[model samples]
Target: MSWSIRIGSIAGIRLQLHVTFLFFLAWIALSQGLLTGHAERAL
Candidate 1:
């Protein structure tokens, strides 16, 4: 029973990390796009 609980916790942690990484990746892409647009406007 304890082993099953530990495995569940580990799976949850992995899922959380995956979600965090995806969020950051999306944020970086959005920021990059905004910066590129700003640079074009300046030019």
Candidate 2:
């Protein structure tokens, strides 16, 4: 959990973004861009 950054809180519960989740997101975007052939689509 040390790799996660605190994002915010919701109703006393904390939210965080893990480092692996970021990489997973990047992978998704890259795959989408490759499939669509549109770099802007990755954003």
Candidate 3:
């Protein structure tokens, strides 16, 4: 499966976002939110 997407480009340089990185961020936020019981702090 594809893991990243080329969203756009700037000055002939491609800008892409890796799906796994996003998953990692979400996991961190979710775990932190659960531990602290505060959404703001998780972010």
Each model's TM-score, in the order given?
Answer: 0.45, 0.68, 0.68
How much lDDT does each candidate structure score? Answer: 0.52, 0.90, 0.88
Off by over 4 Å in 1: 1-17, 38-43
lDDT, residue 42, model 2: 89
Which scores greater on lDDT, model 1 or model 2? 2
Question: The CA-based lDDT of model 3 is what?
Answer: 0.88
Best by lDDT: 2
State the lDDT of candidate 1 residue by residue for 1-43, as single tens digits: 1222222345356322344566777777777778888533332
Backbone clashes in model 1, listed as residue pairs: none
- Candidate 2 residue runs with Cα over 4 Å from true position: 39-43
Q: Model 3 has how many clashing residue pairs?
A: 0
Give the C-alpha miss distance for residue 32 in model 2, angstroms: 1.0
Model 2: per-residue Cα lDDT over 1-43, one tens digit each: 3999999999999999899999999899988998999867786
lDDT of 2 at 32: 91
Model 3 lDDT tens row, 1-43: 7888889999999999999888899889989898888876776
- Superposed on all Cα atoms, the candidates' RMSDs to the truth, in angstroms, are 10.3, 2.3, 2.9
